[model samples]
Target: MTGETAPVAARDEADPVAVIEVQAAVLTRNFELLRRRSGFDSQLDRAGYLLLLALDSLGPSDIGTLAAALGLDPSTVGRQVAAAEGKGLVTRNPDPQDRRRSVVTASPDGLARMAELSVARQRRTTKMLAGWSVEDLAQLARMFTRYNEEVAHHYFTGIDQVGCAAPHDQPKHSTAEDDS
Candidate 1:
């Protein structure tokens, strides 16, 4: 029964809050499935994932720039980079313009692996929204994206200002937190 689908279970009687809670649980379970399939958890711990994500979005960046982008200390990001390099997921090379400075790049293999994982992640998302119409899905995406951006800008910036700097740019995006 490796590929067998599970039977659908009925939901209990629910108030609005209870319905929301059940939806949250279902979303969380779907997310966990995506993570497991992606193998991101096994490949890179939280720090490594952040580093890879930063590199993927920003391209080759100096340690200081990466640290600033992540709102983390340079030394901490340096250590994370070292770990990524050791796994052949990233490489740190001397900046051509400034030989003293270094730029980090995600390795080709790393990019390929990430792409595969991304596809698997997308499949999970599609399954989650299977019943939604295209317009509804589009609207949901827009609203969620805007909400996330606002929360990150407001809360994360405030945390940084108050000196609660973490190595990751934003805390891991949890379904519960996002829904809340």
Candidate 2:
């Protein structure tokens, strides 16, 4: 980041792939900082946000199912679910089929909170890209989605609909580790 960066929407034709990687790493750290300093006192933390998001998309599910969807360990998901439940953001009820297991679901209150958090984040992002055109914003979103998919492909095994390997099946190229 010492020298002049490439123009917006432009790639540096001269830099090697390693240089791009380094820049990407810096960009992620910078984005994290931006999120932290955005002056929004978000009620939902990252774990809770992600958990609700997964539950919203997947419907009510057992902790193990939610954990798999979120790419988190069940223990970690359990702790998060507990915290959210304490906040009235989520609930865990006895699974109908299996009386011993609890199924976690995002409460209506949780979804409302999540929506507010999402709007706040989106506002911050819109402010940051104030001058960007709609087409540019779309392109940026597409590129980021592509990059995220590639990252998940290499690091996670249980991503659905991407033809990724199942939990017990490991792809040769993926040395699975929870880098997050």
Candidate 3:
């Protein structure tokens, strides 16, 4: 039954949310399938990857600051930092301003690993979307960004996470009058 389509229940054609839900489910599987097919693997797990991204964006920070920016529990961040440290993916130093506190940063090895992962992912995506128009990709990016923001807004309040520092920006389109 490989690549067999599931039987979908007939729902209201006008129900956009229902359609979105169905498509979202398909997208989750699509990513899994694509990743497997692409053979792109990473040593960094999702949490560690995100933690590293936050560090890259904000620079060295104490656990509390990192947790606050990422909207994660400080205890959870502490454990993640510990695990990352064990893997030599991050380094912790006593804060110069306050020796009692530790500042955590992604190690050089971690940054190199992440860079490799990112380039592999980008290559995979580019190949997957080889024929897509730039406008089409831009539209999808905008929609995805909006969807992520909405989901975050619903689940978390006052989150100031990396890659979401500001509201999504769009290029201004020129009208016919503007061409004059």
Candidate 4:
């Protein structure tokens, strides 16, 4: 680890909140780097990329569904979808079940572009974590998955009622080092 990251790692072992804060900062920096390195920033903005990902993961969906899933306003999603459609990245079809609603899906070209971007991201991530052992990578993956699951559960369970919970307050688990 670099002199900069060593302090953060030391703090992470003692303070879960510190770890979370550092993780957030790292994610923000990584996202900016990825946006610059990948050509997606030139072709699509953050909202567009998120919309495409939602469509890819959730299949064809209506504007309202996409908006809710993405935590974006419906009008915002509508405009993004329109822009993507114009760029031939997405297609709109009348919902068979409801003629009044139109569902959006990625076009063949969009899928191909998304696939290319995915590969680029994977390659970049692999290179960035090149020194990490397999066990370390697996631990990171598990930790991220667990964190996301907890946040999702809290979010979907009525954020007004439950509010956000601190990571350390949730539960305790064996450290990655303990797994060895």
Candidate 5:
């Protein structure tokens, strides 16, 4: 007897939201896996991790500047920084040029911890790319870099607003198509 095939639903031409949602979910899961493998998730929550990254990248920065860069409230940034300070991972000091401002910097211990985390992250990333050829990896990286740049540009240009939206706040744009 011939086997019968199951019916499959046709793709919706108008919906893109589902596409974005799925992509976001996949990226989130990948990041979670990476963080877990690197022991980052166990050591710090997302905010704290971000704080560490900012300190690493920007060197010492005043609380206000850090808060702005992180898109977090000043109080929230302060709390996270305080926690990092308490762990002896960072130091808070009065800004040399501005007595009214305080800057946060990663301490020696923090840098060492970050180095360990970085190595773990790199190892995981390398494993994930192991199946890809160098050319393929380079192409993939280029696409990702371009996408990131475009997205950041859109956000910074005020074309893609960033704020909490109620269910009613979503634009009435068609969600039936997957742009990808």
Candidate 6:
């Protein structure tokens, strides 16, 4: 459902679980839209763009390194690199240190296209957050960074140990008469 029409449970804004759920939904939808706009729906799939970006940032890297940087499987990154190579957006070269492994890097054309896309994306993001005050933007950045770090820590450790209890296990904080 669209955010405007979605039914929200009657819960206080201070309720951590409810706030997290709503924010997660909002961020997921926004990221999906951003992904489509950033060429995921076109010739460059999300994997390709991400792979190219990683290559651009990290220079030539083997499949395993790229996969680890992008939090993807090596096989998946290999496929993405192959597809990007087919599109002339990236090139694979023999790793100097490892004869059996290949290192991937963004091609000149890919670099140029990536620069153009980055500018466009920056413009889009600026426009999207034009209504927000500087403080709000800063707060969002800080909060998002903290949230991501927490998620990553939990993922690396055990999420079950992070106290992400099931919904049914949560204490009932809402009263029937308070349904909004």
Runs in model 2 deviating more than 4 A are: 1-13, 39-41, 158-180
Model 4 residue 75 distance off true place after TM-score fit, in angstroms: 2.3
Give per-residue CA lDDT, model 5, range 137-158, as digits (tens): 8897776766654543433221
lDDT of 3 by residue, 1-180 (tens): 787678553376478878776777778888888666665544677677788888888888899888766666789999999999999989999999999999998999988877777788888788979899999999888888777666555443333435423333322455788444
Model 2 Cα lDDT, one tens digit per residue, 1-180: 876556333255467775666678779877787668764436788788888888887889888887777666789989999999999999999999999999898999999988898898998789989999999999998887777556555655455432222454343363346343
Query: How do the candidates rank by TM-score, highest first?
Result: 2, 3, 6, 4, 5, 1
Q: Measured by C-alpha RMSD in angstroms, how accurate is candidate 1? A: 7.5
Steric clashes per prediction: 0, 0, 0, 0, 7, 0
The candidate that wins on lDDT is: 2
Give the 10-residue window scoring lowest on summed lDDT in candidate 5.
157-166
Better of 3 and 4 by TM-score: 3
lDDT scores in order: 0.70, 0.76, 0.75, 0.72, 0.66, 0.69
Considering every candidate listed, which one attains the maximal TM-score? 2
Clashing pairs in 1: none
Q: Which ten residues in a row have the lowest lDDT in candidate 2?
A: 162-171
TM match of model 5 to true structure: 0.66
Over 62-133, each residue of candidate 4 has an lDDT whose tens digit, in order, gives: 998787666556898899999999989999999999999999998888877777776777888899899999
Candidate 6, residues 1-180, lDDT tens digits: the string is: 455545454366788878777778777987997787566346466566667777777788888777666655689888888989998999999999978999888999887777776677778888989999999988987787677545544332211221221112222344666434
| Root-mean-square deviation (CA) per prediction | 7.5, 5.1, 9.7, 9.1, 8.7, 9.6
Clashing pairs in 2: none
Q: State the lDDT of candidate 1 residue by residue for 66-107, as single tens digits.
A: 876666779999999998889898998999999999989999
Candidate 2 yields a Cα-based lDDT of 0.76
TM-score of every prediction relative to native = 0.61, 0.78, 0.78, 0.70, 0.66, 0.72
